[model samples]
Target chain A: MKQLTFDVAVIGGGPAGLAAALAAKEQGATRVLIIERNLELGGILQQCIHHGFGLHRFKQELTGPEYAQRFIDMVCRTDIEVMLETMVLEITNQKQIYAINQTQGMMQIDAKAIILAMGCRERTRGALRIPGTRPAGVFTAGAAQRFVNIDGYIPGKRAVILGSGDIGLIMARRFTLEGAEVKAVVEILPYAAGLTRNVVQCLDDYGIPLILQSTITCIHGKERIEGVTIAQVDQDWNPIAGTERDISCDTLLLSVGLIPENELSSQVGIQLDPVTNGPAVDSNLMTSIPGIFACGNVLHVHDLVDFVSQEAETAGCAAAAWASEKQYSSTRIIASTGKPGPCCPTSDSIPFDGVANECCATWGSTQIIIKPGNNIRYVVPQRICPDKKTTLYLRVRKPDQDVSINVGELKRMKHTFIRPSEMIKINLTPELLARHQSDYLDIHVVKEMVHHD
Target chain B: MIKTVICTVCPLSCEVELTISATNEIEKIMHNRCPRGKSYATTEHIAPRRTLTTTVHIEGAIHSMLPVRTYEPIPKELLHQVMQETANINVTSPIKMGDIIVRDILGTGVNLIATRSM
Candidate 1:
């Protein structure tokens, strides 16, 4: 086995990893390495050939490959090391990394700081628990996307897509353009799980019917997919018996949801937030394990890749600071204690076990706990250091118009509308955070009512 | 007559309702949050356009295929013809990003450019 050492090691080499590695290098981290399992530096972005990316970061519409190429070009100009076609086997809390590649055989990397950017995986049909025999044509929307976009192979002639995610919506249009018949896109939620732009451009423009509050209850066929049984669900999501109908199609695409990839984080004992299913991070995006930080989808599922890069840059700069032995007072305060703290009181209480609390002992520089209150789904960076400004990304439980996102009487931002499908970002400045008297900052959403005259 | 069109310019996806005159000119636009949404709804109500993104066959490259997209949004009705024209194209390696694979695609003045370098 060969041994190597670096100041920072980034896993995945996707959008998040690319941004993190570049930021770390720019932040004076002399030795930075990015380990990617794919043959190229771009991860899932390679297969995502559609445009509408980089709108926020670049202020222009770009395809996934185009967005990733910009970062890849920047990385190539720097001295950051990249290992393509390398699979990371294990990662320890001590910042030790184990990985393997065809040429290097077994390799071990000792790093001063590690960044988790493994990204997220698409939820499969098996996880949905749809009753049916094993079939060959059933595929996740992402797999089909890779097949058609990258591999140039159409999955089938006819298709019925479940879960109106962005991928599923895009695939519906792609299949139509490829001359494949897309019957309908069935979504379990009342509203689409994808961005409104996708639902309009991909589905509405193509004249594809989007059936809401419906789900595929059964997958029919033995060897190959023959058809599926789609039924409308009530408020409880239980299928209405008489509403069951069979749609004849050779292919069934599942785009249910995405779960953050965190096996490596869990292996190293990084505490995860039950709501986000990612590591519990502080304001600097550092995980509970001191030098280890996480960002992007591995930190939480982000609606846009632009935000992922922004968050990763935070993690990268923090990791670089740690590797360079920078004595930031805020870091010292947060890193002093590793024990879990108390959960903030909320009306809709989340289980105490689900919250990973880290209390700090340092004075003058106060540590604040961010709790998701009523109607707020989850907020990233559950802990915060009030010494600096920080952005909190969150989602609401349902759709509402004229809502106010309040952060513990310190700050409030108004929005025309809020939805679970779209993440809401609120920036808390140092002055606003310093004004709060309580150690626990409760973030909640309140729907404003308008009276008709 | 009134027609509702969802603006795809951004994630806001404002559902704009267009009130048209008897001659099909847009009389009023409602529910649009921004000027882009208003213009997007106007164009969509009149003539829909979409940017085409797909892969073309490539040889002597690191990968068997190269992802490409139109330089600008073309008429939505012409997407099928554009895809058909792209399907017959085969390019060689050393292609650079933004390099034109097919110029003036389908006479719409929109060129299909390579989205990535191979």
Candidate 2:
């Protein structure tokens, strides 16, 4: 086995890895390496051909590949090393990596810092457990996207989307443009799980029905997809008895949700937030293992790629700083040594029953724990440094009009409306956080009194 | 007549309401968080436009499909027709990003260009 050394090793050569590597290089970290599993560097962005990315970062609309190309071009201009078609098998707390590729049979990489940017995977049919015979046409919205956009093969003619997420909404339009009929986009929630722009442009533009509060109860097929049985559900998501209706379609695409690809994260025993299903890191994006950092979808699934780039860059800069100063000593990858950080960061604000794996490790003794309160689903960067200026990404549990979000006496901003689909950002300046005296910060959405003006 | 236009300029999705006079002119605009929504409502009322984004078949490329989009938003009604025209178009690889795929597509005066190099 050939052994190589790099200052920083970024896993997964997607938008996250590309941006992170670029930032690390810009931050004076030489010999940065990116390991990609695919033949190309642009991760899912290659298959995401439609525009709407880079709105925040570039202030202009850009296609996924275009957004990715800008970062790729920047990395190309630098001396950053790239290892394509390489699959990282394991990562150790000692900052060593074991990866394999066709060209390199087995290689070991010694790095001062590691960045996880593997991104997220789409939720599939097996996860849904929809009662049905094994069908050939059933596919995840992302899988269908790759097939059509990259492989140049349309999955089916008439399709029914199970989730009204951005992927499903985007694919609904894509299928329509490709001369396929998108019969309906069924979502269990009363509102769309995706952005309002996607719902308007993708479905409303094409006159595709977005059936809210409805879900596919059963999928019927023997060889290929024949049709699906959809039903309206109650508040608890239980299907109503007489609301079942059959929609005959050749394809049933599931855009249920996304899960952070944390298989390798767990392999290295990185602490994960139960709500985000990603790494539990501090304000600096540093995971439990000192030198290991996470960003982009690997940290939390972002609604936009622009946010992903912003986050990955932060992780990159932090990784570069870590590589410069190797100050960490011990490895507490074992959960028994975990600090049991703040129980669950979700709505249930109670501590765990002394379960080690259930809680994440606290970054420091003085790190303020951010807890979700009221209607807030979860807040990323579960821990924060009081003196640092930090931005906390959060999501609401439901949609509401005219609400003020309070961040532990740090700040309060009024919003015209808030929804689960749109992520809310709370900026905590050091001056504002100086007013916060508590060791833990509770973020909650509070209803303001109606103004008579 | 009143029209509620959802501003797609940003993720805020401000619901802008526009009041149109009988002379087919906008009399008042309300509820927009920014000036972009005002222009969006005016343009949407007279002639709604949309940027068409889709894939076209490409030969001699690493990937068989090439993503293309309009340089600027064309009339919203021309989207389906433009897509139909785009389906018949194919290009060879080694094309640069921003290269014109179709000039004056459907005579809508909007050029379809490649968004990424192949």
For model 1 the local lDDT of residue A153 reads: 91
For each candidate in turn, the TM-score is 0.95, 0.94
The local distance difference test score of each candidate is 0.88, 0.86
Q: Per-residue alpha-carbon lDDT of model 2 for A1-453, expressed as tens digits? A: 999999899999999999999999999897899999999898999889888889889988888988988888888999999999999999998889999999889999999999999999999898988987888999999999999998889999999999999999999999998899999999999999999989988998899999999999899989999999999999999999999999999999999999999999898888788889998877778776767899989888989888888888888987887687433232233234654444333323332112122323423324567788999999988777666778899999999988999997768889889999898888888788878776679999999887867
Summing lDDT over every window of 10 consecutive residues in candidate 1 chain A, give the lowest-scoring window.
A355-364
**Candidate 2: what lDDT?**
0.86
For model 2, residues B15-89, the per-residue Cα lDDT tens digits are: 899988899889999999888888987898889998888889999988899988999999998888888888888
- Which ranges in model 2 have alpha carbons more than 4 Å from their true place? A326-365
How far in Å is the alpha carbon of B37 misplaced in model 2? 1.3
Locate the minimum summed-lDDT window of 10 residues in model 2 chain A.
A351-360
Interface RMSD of 1: 0.9
